[model samples]
Target: MAEGGQIDTDILSDEAFDVLCSMCKNQGKNTEGEQYCVDCKDYFCVSCVKVHSKVPLCAGHKVLDKSQIKSRTSKGLPRAPTERCDRHSHKHIDMYCQKHDTVGCSTCMAVDHRLCKDTFYIPEFIQNNTYQVVATREIQTKLKALDTILAEKADRFKQDKQRLLKRKAEILADIRKFRQEINDHLDKLEKSSINEIEDKVKSLEDKIKDSLKQLQANKSRITSINDKLTSTNTNQSEVFVYVKMAEDAATVAYKYIDDSELQCTTEDIEYQPDITIPTQLEEKKTLGTLAKKHTKTSVSLFQI
Candidate 1:
């Protein structure tokens, strides 16, 4: 009876190991795992190893003996046969939620799939032979499709990144070009304004110099007339003529001075900048509006 119990335990262990072995599980075969493939991260029975060795894809795979597996296990490495939940690392995945079309742990079932209508214990679900056939076909098909989608998405992402980088460079170039255009325009305007100011100053200076020359000439004439009037040898008629000439010269000088004062009035030049340019620039948030265009393309994978 004790030997029979031992036999039964070994059979159960073999069955459990087969469940964890990719080769045995997929082939729907019952086999006791004897070796571990390091590269594949899977256990293989003697028969499975023979099959694995025959496959060209398994050429470089490294296999370890039971002793090595035991040694690794002793060093805290988990022995293959138990599939752990990705979300709950401490818990094993043993339940399936059909509604969500996902396999998860007991904790996942309790926390996430509690309200799901079609949840099942995986071990019990797998007892139905139809489940294996359907799962194998559908899962394999979906996995292949997902792989294709992933590859396409990766390519698209690369293309998009390149396109965006190119667009960014173009935008920066355009902005710099626009700024250069503005600088060029401002430089031209500055040169023109400076020339205008210089012309105005030159004109004003010329008028003041001309007025000064005239005033000086009038002063000289008046001085000469006064000197003639003071002469002792001059007669009364001559003196009266000299005095009249002096009065007329003084009147002309005063009138010229009054006229010159109006013409040579000291005034400063001032510049008023247009407030709108800077005010609008400060209020502006962006150079231009960024817009998104939606385009749709349909893809058919594994149509047949």
Candidate 2:
């Protein structure tokens, strides 16, 4: 309820006041509130109040009609149930087992308290005993404490969620950094290998080119000697001298050709990569393992 655009907390205790029937509103109906159930913490229409009165659990609950609601002061603001069963999350607290001195939902009576001979409906039990102001105050105090504990837990859980998200982002970044580092190292190794191959091939090419030049020089000298011997104007002594020079040249060329044989052979260069690198990588299941440590806060479970 609001007055002058401000909530009237005194009239409704710590809760926001609603004039509509909560039960009807849940069923998608808009009905005016006729009565308020202090135990259920809900407003109800005339029809719903009748149902509430008939229920063994809610029959004896403290209620206020519309006239009483308007006249009641802040001194005795009603205390009501939060209305959920602790064990059966979907069920509501609606029964009391006097034999075990326990209260729970109807399911609890059916399963665990069926054998108890002293069981009584929650409202019937309340009706049998005189209502005490101390009991209502005690219940209100517990509700306030529970609300505080739940609020703290909610805040902590939200903080933990944010922390987990941040941790995940950091881990992902580290993985990408590791991958980039490996790629850089491999790139350097590849460049060095290429340089080494080029250097060796260039050295071998220079040696082969030098050997070919010497062989060509020897062939030219032999051809010049043959031309001198075939000429009709050349004397016999000159021909003999030229033939002798050719024989000396042939012996030197033969020795050079034998020494250069391996250098002049056709060759193909190839690179053999280290297979162990890839093999080890394939054998690995992960870059690293992810782990977590958790600490649970002790909290007393709320019961109806």
Winner by lDDT: 2
Q: Please report, in order, the local distance difference test score of every candidate based on alpha carbons.
A: 0.46, 0.49
lDDT of 1 by residue, 1-304 (tens): 0010011121122212222466777788766678887546687887788788788877645565554443222222222213455677755455556675566666777788667766654433443213323333343343334334334443543443344334444444444444444434344434444454445445544644565466557656655555554452223223323333455555676676567546432322222333343335444433333322222222211010
Candidate 2 Cα lDDT to native:
0.49
Q: In model 1, what are the clashing residue pairs, if there are any?
A: none
Candidate 1 — what's its lDDT? 0.46
Estimate, for each residue in 82-109, the C-alpha lDDT of model 2 and write its tens digit.
3456577655454556555455666667
TM-score of 1: 0.32
Give the Å error, residue 131, model 2. 2.6
User: Lowest-lDDT window of 10 residues in candidate 1?
Assistant: 1-10
